[model samples]
Target: MEKWLVVLGIWAMCAACAVLFIRGATAGSDRRASVREGARAASRGSAGDTRAALND
Candidate 1:
């Protein structure tokens, strides 16, 4: 019973870490895209940029 409890705790901790890591990664990706969008907006001469921004 003690061994099972220890295993369960470890599994729970790992699951929590995985969830946090995924959320952090997605947030970073969103921030990067947002910055790119702003840059695209600033470059008013590029039609491709507009298309890419819309696709994203």
Candidate 2:
């Protein structure tokens, strides 16, 4: 019974680590994507402003 408990504890720890790693990876990807989108939007807005200025 003791041996079984030890094995189960190890398995649970491994599963928890895997879940944390996956969550971190996904969160990082999402953060990067949001940053990229924000930058793109800023650039587009600047370009539009420049075009309007040129027209004026």
The lDDT for every candidate, in the order shown, is 0.93, 0.99
User: In candidate 2, which residue pairs clash?
Assistant: none
After TM-score superposition, the amount by which residue 29's alpha carbon in candidate 1 deviates from its true location, in angstroms, is 0.7
Model 1 C-alpha lDDT per residue in residues 1-56, reported as the tens digit of each score: 99999999999999999999999999999999999989988786588778989999
Give candidate 1 misplaced runs (Cα > 4 Å): 45-56
Enumerate clash totals for all models, in the order shown.
0, 0
What's the CA error at residue 56 for candidate 2, in Å?
5.7
Can you write out model 2's per-residue Cα lDDT over 3-41, one digit (the tens) per residue?
999999999999999999999999999999999999999
Global Cα RMSD, each model: 8.7, 1.6
Model 2, residue 22: what's the lDDT? Answer: 100
